[model samples]
Target: MSSASLKRLAVAVVAAAGAFALAMPTASATPARDNVKDKAEVIGKGKEKEKTVPVRLLSINDLHGNLEPPTGSSGRIADETGTVVDGVGGAAYLATYVKQYKNKDTVLVAAGDLIGASPLLSAAYHDEPTVEFLDMLGLSTSSAGNHEFDEGYTELKRIMKGGCHPVDGCSPAGKWKGSKFDFIAANVLDKKNKHALAPFYLEKINGEKVAFIGLVTATTPSIVTASGIAGLKFTEEVAAANRTSKFLAKRGVKAQVVLVHEGDQVTPNQSPDACPVVPGLGSRIANGLDAEVDLVISGHSHQAYICKVNDPKGNPRVFTQGSSFGRVLTQIDFQIDKNTGDIVRSSVVADNHVVRRTVTPDAQTVAFIDLWKSRTSAVANKPIGRITADMPNTASASGEVPLGNLIADAQLEGTKTGGNAQIALMNPGGIRAGLTYAGSSAGEGDGVVTYGEAFTVQPFNNLMQVVTLTGAQLKLLLEQQWVGGPNNQAFTKILQPSSNFTYTYSTSAAWGTKVSNIKIDGQPVTDAQTIRVAANNFLVGGGDAFAAFTSGTDLWSGPLDIDAFAAYLGAHSPVAPPVANHITVIP
Candidate 1:
């Protein structure tokens, strides 16, 4: 800890907090500007002054198989979009970020979603690249996100141990590597015996005992497909955290924190143009948590915020979460009584830095990503299609995207040839990718969206399904998007229907309202009408945490989403991705 720098920082903190006080509360806050000293708890009886040790933690969540820096999406996401904040998610910039703040005491952590349903860039390389990147960045450990189980426990075990997949031929001369950090899951259970997989992880840092309890939302089984996690069960988060904290205490560790992939429930603030950063589900979890845990870091909801609130147990806990895609990082600093090893008080300081792709990559880290990049370049660079303009895929987990609409359309078009297909539906989770537009690289670039871009847009191998749904049943599916959670508002809006059909939605109405004006092929759908539709099997089997999809009638599995997309791009060759011209909610 540098005393001189701390003094300078202290002075700046006071001056900035004064300025911020003029505005009172704000959506985004800075430590220097917010003057957080007043909010901290004083330790040592305020008699003796000890130098505050600034523990800098750099964190990211939901990496979801991103290996390259900013320009990975046919160099699209690395380039441009209103929703797209540029940052190379690859390990190089991350390594640089870690090194700048890292002393022997620094901690690097992730909330969840670091793998699964990944792109060929990482998946083609068998998620080798992502693991290698994290190892290079020196991640402390991570809580298990749902995607970790996409291939079931077998693959996850292989990833942890062998660091590679059992691909017939990933390399005759190469190796698959595992991550540097341990993966802990406090709550994921095996149903056969109802036992925890990896309970919790604790470490001694700077002579202070810090405990980490990892968990995912209990409803994860419903969010992911039943098949992918058929024999496993996810337990309630708060209960799991409490139990794990007790376990750590028995092991002689006191300071406790929770790393969860679940996020908050927030609507856009009054300023729609500026993304509304508000307390999300993370906030709720913090409020309901046990007193033992001192901090909570959240993801999955994709909103950025920091707050100090009392849990249901009435113990104060500091909570923070940066938005997704490595755009920002939340750093928490605290003081623990040396004798008792209890956190006296803490201040929340955060820095949201973009992963600027054009910046020089850290040599060693860049080499790691490049080695895999060169090996997978053949499929990575293959031209998929051309988009004259951008089809931005920047919506948060709780929102919709224009690219989602386009892909849904493509699924509809490709599946409609048979008598089984009429309307196309998509799960927000399955559409894990986006198409690249022409001018997405740093400055002026190409107008052609390639096949690689389309593949990136539809990364999951979730096959497409044409199912039969009665008009009433379709309405039921829409309603499931928000029900069966701890609350009515626990989820986001359902994927919007294609232009050929339109549905009415009202937040004022309770969940599961009908698609009143439902139209298909210029005809209104009535109760007696049974319509054929295209949806992913995950949705058909009630994925998205939406249970209604479990009832799709007369199911038929067609080509997987990526293959269908390839066909759509081929037919629309040299065509701009159909812009999101239709579909609107009538207020």
Candidate 2:
């Protein structure tokens, strides 16, 4: 074996010995709360002037409040052979996997999206359960995702600082004690103080200090609700990481890692351990980082991969991401030079592991999930309606889906009670999951739809609104679905239109002219014609870059989106999948 390999093995042995010694019962038997002091004493024993230390980093991202096993496509895992494996992802299973891989040197962290857009189980209690779960898993630190600001900065602070919610008061979990982990945001700045929310977190591992810098995507403001980020500024990611690394260096900390909430898309069917052929934002950030920054962990795009991209100084550094919803966990191992407190760049290695359910689940997590499930059972189990078949949220080339169409139709019908709504448009991102024919739990029969299922489909609870828009403005809204628009979506986000609306768009046409042949009820919509449209307040406020919606007039507020959807389900029993022919795509 090479000298470097031998050195790494020795370091691992020492770390394992230290961990075993710490686990054994002693006379004093007092739990060690000071990590640095404990590590120093454990590694300081005879002939232990070793110049290297082994460190393990275990990470997960985009959990999105899935305390229970995710249903439908969200629960599946993809292997290197392009085969899909089912029945994965539950907090209990995740906890089991985390414990299996954890060692004394392990430092657990997450890139972002730990909560927000959560399922009804977690969302019912404002995601306090997820926070508790992370604390139990011993998360050391994490970055903030755009969804972290879903309820605004004050609520985010409440999540981090621990307290009863200002509005919802205390949950069944009682007064919230916030998260035990540090949430560091190097790029997110307080507009009033001109300082970062939580700039950097420092960890001392085996007598060496390591710095973790966290950052959200620079495009946070464009995607998140406007009011949620009114007083915060998200700066460029690379610059923020570079500046943070410089600051850490001045403090005599050289081992640096960046936990960013932005990531790149990988080719379909590729192995999670494969490097990208064409790098995206995550790769760009990793490649542009200063030499002092040794590693990057990313999330948001939800793609799983392990890559080695070159830094600005042409030295290769590790970059990795795990898929969303607790289905995968990334394990990164590296060696640090104890003398210099610098990471051995050549010793870094990373791999993605599937959270397979075959193993024994953590009993505590299972009971915790059951506690929340029973608490929410009364409302969650109430029958909303029935379906003839599954209404999958999967979209086609034109971006239309059975569930999206149903949601838009429901919004239009619900809003028509007070406003003359002709059509409704639903953003694709708003649809979280699909309606399965086989119900989630016991007591519910096949094809039966419950309030929990409906809530899962539309969890945002955005208020419905009706507004008047000219036919000209409607065309602009359709054009905004593609690139070169204010939102700059990576792909075309075809708005899910109600049954009355039909439109065709040409892929070959120019940006503004891509959308053509717009109509309502098979009648051509004239440029000067004004139509009343039904949509969620998010769309009306120009969320997701559909700025044309902001120009609408004669606005009228309606019911919460989930309530409207539930009422629609109850009103129309035995609902069948809507024909996916609303939007036409021209080659």
Candidate 3:
């Protein structure tokens, strides 16, 4: 079948192997804390004595729907000594770990990013397989990550409340049933209702009430495409969590866990169990949390660490993040006093464990993943292009990456005819993975790039947009790359320019004057010049703190970013890595 026909069929049947209906379904402590199992404890004296309920909380974050074992750097994690541990994650292996650690009082949960930016096996069906996988694994609740809003709030509601896709009806598997597990967002509120989509989810652990307050990062609005999240408001994470904690406390729910999809990045090669003090959003929120909030499980930064941060009342609290793609799981054990229904802060112990593939994989989970693979394989396996060598995401001294340059070039080519785009700038964050020349386990020949592989590299499906910006505004866009600038970026995020665009920047130059010698097609640009720029809608709308892009005029929307990339690959078969020489760095 031709590519177009295959695409139609894929959309029609979703992967076509099964005939079924759609159903929707669904922390840490030590850097190396010893095994602390959940056990009831005795408190009080004689007649007044009661058994304190012990609760075991198991968590994973930033899963990003890796039904199969992740490969490369995404699959490995650092040990206590900073040694890399490989072959760490797969859904089946993760399930085996969960089973071993779970007890009668165990509640499995996540800190958001359960879906979005997924592999082809999951993203093909709009991540329905991931939703089913979570439900099958017995997830109880989760927070909503910023990526959860990738397609917008309406689709998120559909994912939560079961329904057929408005555009593409039921998959070959039949009607979709929303998630059985709850997704709470304390900070994301509806503009009209002035209430959160779901403030919090309450779980009962052996008669003890545990409140899970889910919150997305407050900077969600600045990161996600503004259009998808139209009519929604993202408030401050710390304030929202505190407000929710106080409300739940008034209602007699004392044991609280804040699962916010925001976190800090630890040093590379940092041990997962080590608690090094880092100034991160996760640290700030954990420290600002009310004393009533006993634990904070976080995601978004995709770093794994078991850090101890003190709450507002100076009580030691555990703040953790399990590495992304199901590579790590955090086990938290705490006891609730039966008399006061409050958590014993001293009893809290948290540890991070690798989801090692050494264990026997869960039979049920293997079968489940295989089922989805069979369905998605038809479209996923089709070859789109070829590559001479791997185009990894490794950045140069100037912070430009070959993969990002290729993507920007693709975006530029994709928009030239339709939108008359003269230049394209791709955000580093938008490029998820690299293209490899070697064939994957799927049996596609080496040097062959399949549609699935391409999709994995650019999975967000952001629209390709062309907008006109004056040379001055364009200069401001480049100036926003570093700290102490108009945009106040946390770190330098040099935009990957197309092969035709070039510029120079000096780290020692004063803010706003760092960028110079801006050129498009070998011509120096003037302040009064107007240039057509091509980028994903997210960046064009000011994502990644590039607010200068919002000043562009004459907006022109084209195909989905993924489509543009795939088309570029097909047209430029036997593609090779682009040089990261477009940007010049100065001392």
> If the candidates were sorted by their lDDT against the true structure, best first, what order would they fall in?
3, 2, 1
Question: How well is each residue in 1-587 modelled by candidate 3, as lDDT tens digits?
Answer: 23333233223322221321221011011001111112232243562455577889999999998989987667789976789988998899999999899987898989998999998899888888999989888888899999888878888878877798898788778899887876777777665434345556666666667778888998888889897789988878887777767766765778889999999888888888877746778888889988999899999988999888888878898889898999998999999898888889889898889888989999999998999889989999999888899888778899999989989999999999979999999999887777878899899989999998888888998999999999999999999888787665867788999999999999889988999999999999999999999999999999999999999999999998989888998999889999889999887
lDDT of 2 at 298: 94
Cα shift from native, residue 497, model 3 (Å): 0.9
Report RMSD for candidate 3.
10.5
Better of 1 and 3 by lDDT: 3
* TM value for model 3: 0.91
Score each candidate by Cα lDDT: 0.62, 0.82, 0.82
**Runs with alpha carbons beyond 4 Å of true place in candidate 1:** 1-55, 71-90, 167-173, 193-196, 265-280, 312-315, 346-360, 394-401, 417-419, 439-445, 481-489, 504-514, 577-584
Per-residue lDDT tens digits of candidate 2, residues 211-243? 777889887876777788888788888887786
Poorest 10 consecutive residues by lDDT, candidate 2: 27-36
Off-target runs (Cα >4 Å) in candidate 2 are 1-41, 44-47
Error of 2 at 239 (Å): 1.4
Off by over 4 Å in 3: 1-51
